[model samples]
Target: MTYIAEQERYDKMTYNRSGKSGLRLPAISLGLWHNFGGINVLENQRAMARRAFDLGITHFDLANNYGPPPGSAEENFGTLLKQDLAPYRDELIISTKAGYYMWPGPYGEWGSKKNLVASLNQSLTRMGLDYVDIFYHHRPDPNTPLEETMSALDLIVRQGKALYVGLSNYSAEQTREASRILKSLGTPCLIHQPSYSMLNRWIEDGLQDVLDEEGIGSIAFSPLAGGMLTDRYLNGIAPDSRAAGPSVFMKPEQVTEERLAKVRKLDELAKSRGQKMSQLALAWVLRGGRVTSALIGASKVSQIEDAVGALAALEFTGEELALIEGILQG
Candidate 1:
């Protein structure tokens, strides 16, 4: 069956510039961190991909080690691209990263040039892409020289393997340094991906300022905090939920009574705004347009729809903002 995208796909969704870059990304981008793996149903993955694009989500994020067996998510997305999204390839902002434990060896992980180049080669092969829109260093390598890593990114761009380069999980100081290096290399850092949510606000401490100073846009991963900000755990963890599962991303014990109290209060606020808990979290992350995009992972097509719906009401009143601060401070 031929997949015809919704003609009105770009009508409702908002696209924001990535910092000072000419490239614009949907406010909500899809992350293939969970699900969309080899272990999951390909049909469901296909549905999610189609629904997301139909909703004007042009960005699809993946990493070298996203799957359980590693590299499977890219392989699955490759299948999806060929079958459903190949025609729209030029219209998409496909991205993938390297910097995690992929293969067994010292060179398999980290930000070394050898690792980054090899990892992206593998990622490109797995995704069947000649050049990703953006290629990111998954995390700062403690052992590797920062220049070495940034140089690898510059080399990737020079080689036309990636249109732009970015940094992920890099601290404020690290980001500043890398941005300087990349700038010297004539390849400015386009964006930064970091773990950010109401529950996890480390980026606010300093990273946001650095991004602003560097003219680099940001995409927040885990905007829902591993489903902690959603209705999934409102009545306690469900057996089918990620917290109940063996995934290290989210643990059942992390759902403390204290956290639930805050979540409940936030949920009340979301209801008053006629939004779901997930939608509210996403809106909050994208508030004031400080963050370029909120990267969300969905297990179902409905989740993609719900995320896109967050754009309907992204504004927050001063009082609402104060109330949220009070709730979070408690």
Candidate 2:
């Protein structure tokens, strides 16, 4: 069948402004952190991207080192971009980051000026793009001076390599410091990406307050807690799920008996609300206005559709919140 988008795609999902910026991103943004690797089938990755865009998931997130082999996911995504989505570039909010290990030697990783600049250039080359909608420092480097890292981000924006700057995996305190340094250089930090989910409340410890105070948007990564918030492990670990695999982010040991019990209670609550566990999880995160978008990763088109469908019924009652907290606390 020839590819055709749903006619009512845009009308289905809600869009929110990123902080105070003129740009607005979809409530759910697709991340190329998994399933778009070099070892994966090309047709599957292409189909996934096509399906995501067709479903109004306009933002696609990538990084310098996403593939199992590193750097291959961006190359693969670039091929898809040129072949299918090139004509609709203006409609897409593409983002890439640096700060992780990418290449050999000391120049390939971290938050130094040399590493950030070189990494982005390599990322652009792999992505086959002149400029990304947003470029991010993937993580904070204690050894690197904040001024030097912010300077690199400033130069990238001024050089037209990226339209906006972002920071990821930064603490509330570090975010404030980075924001100050970036602002001093006249480059306002636009967004902050952090791993946030119902089970993980690290961001709430103070990160959200910092972002709100600084007027920076937040795009939450792993909002589903690497699929644990879903029904995949409520009964037990599914062989094909992340919890059953050797994932870097979510480990099998982390899903203890106690955690599974909490998940089962949450799953029951979801059924009571007439929604799936995954749907409830995504909705819970998006219900808060602080989140600009939920950065999600899916291996199949159906998964994407299922996640997007939750946007329609995102409201939660005070009692529901209280019950959820009770379950989480227990």
Candidate 3:
């Protein structure tokens, strides 16, 4: 049976302007960092993507090196596009990034023009798309010249390989320089993707200010802090959870007792507000207008439902905010 999107897809979702750009993204965007990999079940990946789009999450994010074997995630997304989402292509805002270790040898990684251009071309082929809506340099390359990196992004835009350019894992100073370079080339930087959460507040130090100053939108990844902010670890780590996965990004040791205590307290606060801890965490990231969207990952359609629920309780009273700060600091 052909899939049809829900008629009420846009009913409850909030769309925020991507910085000063004309694009308005859903407050919650889905990230294909996990569970949509090649080894994973394709039917499940299609379900998550369908559920997300039905809930009005129009933006989907990916990176070239996302799968266990790498590039498989794009292959998975490509399969979904061919089988289910081909008709709703115009309604979606798809994005992908490079600069992480994707292939063998020098041209496979980093911010060099050779790397960025070739990476995007390969990514387009993997996703079976002519142009990605947003193409990001996954991270800054200390050895590469900033001019070369930014210019490659501009060239991709001019060549119609990517509609907009973004930077991920770039520091404030680096972002300012990249934005300036793109502006000079007549291609304004569109967005910045950063790892941010209640447990990870590094972006609050200065990156947020740089983005706001430069009119670059931000979409926060790991808003739940690798599931640490969720109830998933309140009691103990599930053997099947990312914290326990063989090649997990979140090491089991990282889930210390101290962090669990904080999560428990936050969970209580969330209960008082009629939300799950994950929903509260997502809401808090967008509490301030600085972030254009919260990029969430889901292994199941239910996770998407919980994430979308974050929109309902985005407001925090001054006292609640202070209490949260106290728990985080305490």
Expressed as tens digits, the lDDT of each residue in 100-202 for candidate 2 is 9888898889999999999999989998999999999999998999889999999999999999999999999999999998888888999999998889888
Whole-structure CA lDDT of model 1:
0.95
Q: Which stretches of model 3 miss by more than 4 angstroms?
A: none
After superposing all C-alphas onto the true structure, candidate 3 shows an RMSD in angstroms of 0.9
Can you rank all candidates by lDDT, best first?
A: 1, 3, 2
List CA RMSD, all candidates. 0.7, 1.3, 0.9
Worst 10 residues of 3 by lDDT: 240-249
Lowest-sum lDDT 10-residue window in model 1: 63-72
The runs of at least 3 residues in candidate 1 whose Cα sits more than 4 Å from the true structure, single-residue gaps closed, are none
RMSD of 1: 0.7
So what's the TM-score on candidate 2? 0.97
lDDT winner between 2 and 3, please give it. Answer: 3
Between the candidate structures 1 and 2, which one is better when assessed by TM-score? 1
TM-score of 3: 0.98
Give each model's whole-structure lDDT: 0.95, 0.90, 0.93
Work out the TM-score per prediction: 0.99, 0.97, 0.98
**Per-residue lDDT over 12-89 for candidate 3, one digit per residue giving the tens place of the 0 to 100 score:** 699999988999999999999988887899889999999999999999999899875698899899999989899999
